[model samples]
Target: MDLVRHLECFVAVAEESHFGRAAARLGMAQPPLSQRIQRLERELGVRLFERTSRQVTITEAGTLLLAEAREVLARSESFLAAARRIRDGETGLLRAALTPDVSGETVAALLADFRRRHPGLELELRELSTAEQLAAFAAHELDVGLIHHPCDVTGLELGPVLHRDLGVLLPRGAVAAGLDEVPLAALTGYDLVLFPRDSAPAVYDDLLTACARGGYTPAAVRHGRGTSFVRGLVLSSGAVALGPRDTHLLAGPGDTDPDLVWRPLAGAAPAWRHSAAWPKGRGDAAVGAFTDAATHALRTTAGARFEPSARPLHLRPASEYWL
Candidate 1:
């Protein structure tokens, strides 16, 4: 007989003081209940109850075991409750990674909304490049990732988050200042500060291809590991950088240098795309919750007719290509 099962029978019988009543309370036949109690007594070498024709009274051993049995059942109930909460995404840690190019306002708003929805959950945020985020997801070190488009995505599932037109960041009083929009060809004479190609190869390549189409090549290229660092370099060195038109959302009043200005790129600038990624087979509730929160936040912030793409970047039409 299972020890806990027997103990349950014993406790029932001891409390009810009648075989028929105990069996009814346990939703079992009296014979089975009696047998369970007999087995339990035999295993312990002690009679848990003293029985007469009309009455059943628990002995000292029964009283002692009753307390412990109740405690065990209580703890078991607590363990099950905790497990259910974690499975429902009500309690636990959610580890999320993002590329450095992701806007700070975007991430902050996402986390704030997720926290409101799941107060018991803790969030772990890491700022990594798109490639690094993918590596972390592959190793199961990250629960979810916000990454640039045209990623490897071999064993991952992606959901499009946001898309914006490309723009150029230039120092004040630069050669392109008078124009409302800067043509790609007009950037030929300026030193370009760009994120390293290894950090986001497809985005970098698309930028180069677009420039080539415009019949211009950068006079010099300087690499930076992150958006903020590259922007800083552009401010200090009078270099130009290309970024999403909404890049200003990531900046505070004092975040951008007073002399720097962001202007839309004239004619056929490729759109910048970002997506949420996770392991293909991952079924964790926290991952799903975070993804939902991120999608909603992006839509709310974009405030336009934003639509998530149903296909991967590579499969999308040429017009929708992300740079």
Candidate 2:
């Protein structure tokens, strides 16, 4: 008495126009096929076929139901196909968040490549601090995050995506003309502009440790939430900002910020690192596909290789950093 089974029986009989032929087509005995049609007719309060010793004919009611029944079956099959596609990661939505300082060139290239590989997927991207990205991932609001390195990874899977030598962005004329690299010790007396501690504590701590190794603390510190804002502060307030070597790309083309210049930091400065992270144990197919694409993009387009960290940098013993 299953409705779909009844409809199938009805459709097969309606198309074949003979119970014996319908049963042969359905690979069933003719008796059961006849009984199913009778049950369907009784339920609908209409006879669906006219049977004679010489021939069989479909009733008007059977013809109408045949069209509706075929549509239902077709739609059911389409639904299953769509479900399979989603399971296979052939089509879906991916939401990703990233830290503001993540390189624009890297992100754009990665996105373009991923889109080419997964034309059916819809990508939603947002910029957030490392802390915000972590929170969003935990809340299940985000599928992936691009964050600064040395982050806490207690309940997440993370791998490095990019590494670049650190540099200092100083106000124009802050140092003697033509100085290519500024020694860290020379920055001891200068006020520094940096990201807030809570936004990326590990990166903030790394900066502090780097300065401490130079034999002095900064004279003063100013907090900013984004690299652009920090750079602006450096330009107007004469405070130096520490960032990646490619930080100049953040500047608008042809907008001469003659007030700002980038100088590499001397003496083995800690590298600016970025990582891609996702929730631990998440088995979403789209997330898996995206991770694979991101891994490839990082290796090829970004020219960075992922080296798995056995333990997060902050979790390591102090001796590790000292050595």
Candidate 3:
């Protein structure tokens, strides 16, 4: 007996409560439907329905099996739909977005690997503001996105992969004879290079929080919209910028600052958590691969190198706060 036919016959009998009516619904002869039901019962080794001259009703097992049978049929339908899509060669485009602070080094290596793995798949990228990433993802413009966690979007899920801590990047030549580490209090005297107040308010607000904890606010030298440019100014102007773990990445961008150095500040390490997020929808293989690549890169790049960030990068409880 055909498995699907058995399930269909069982569903019909279970619903109509009579073999003749069930056969009418199925547009088949009554004997055929009855035979299908008998075959089904024999296959399962149990009766699914009870019948008498005056009434027909489902057994306890039949009532339970009704929903399960529907679910199995739905799953099979979905599987067939997916196979048809693949056969049609219309796996479809994948849409994505990301935070600007995530560098080529952070994601490029994984993208290269993905390209080698899936050359035919076309990817659409939208370089967006953090707000744009949040809004677009919420609106279904993107298939998946990369962003820092702790964002305010109400209906999205974040899968974190990398850990990045904010650093106080001081000019190389700045002297610290007495202080072993760069204390946030000492930041008041230097010209501060920082991110734009609007572009990353969370990061900027966290900076103020660190300053308040440290007992003073630093004066600004230059502030910018781009993370790359912030590091650039810090290197050349001998000013301070909130640095991230990937600060050394500045070396490749022609940051001629021979004197650039990172000073771990005394406060909660700012969260620069990077994650791959997707809308709550069923995704295709490429989306799965993208999320996996993101996770793999985050795990590989940050697993051991970023333990210091897991805890707040605050002052060492009883030891020197600088590293």
**Against the true structure, what is each candidate's TM-score?**
0.84, 0.82, 0.59
| Candidate 1 CA-lDDT value | 0.75
Task: Sort every candidate by TM-score, greatest first.
Answer: 1, 2, 3
Better of 2 and 3 by TM-score: 2
Candidate 3's TM-score reads 0.59
Q: After superposition, how far is residue 288 of candidate 1 from its true place, in Å?
A: 1.7
**By TM-score, who's the top model here?**
1
Q: Model 2, 1-323: lDDT tens per residue?
A: 69777888888888888888889999999999989989988999998899999878988887777789899878877888888988776777889876776566767777887788788888888988888998898788998877777777778876545666677877667762247778877776678887787887767777777777866477778998566678778767757778765455336432255666677777877676676788887646666656666666556654554543443445433221231
Candidate 3 lDDT over 1-323, as tens digits, reads 67876897888888788888889999999887777887888899888878787767899988889999988878878888867766443355667776666555756766775566556666786666566787787677887777654455456655544666666666666774124456677767767665564554554565566565776565654776575677667666656776665545345332364556665655555546666777665355676667666666655654413334453322222221122
Model 2 alpha-carbon drift over 4 Å, by segment: 18-36, 52-56, 159-161, 249-257, 293-305, 308-323
Q: Against the unseen true structure, what C-alpha lDDT does each candidate score? A: 0.75, 0.73, 0.65
The ten-residue window of minimal lDDT in model 1 covers: 314-323
Question: Model 2, residue 57: displacement in angstroms?
Answer: 3.0
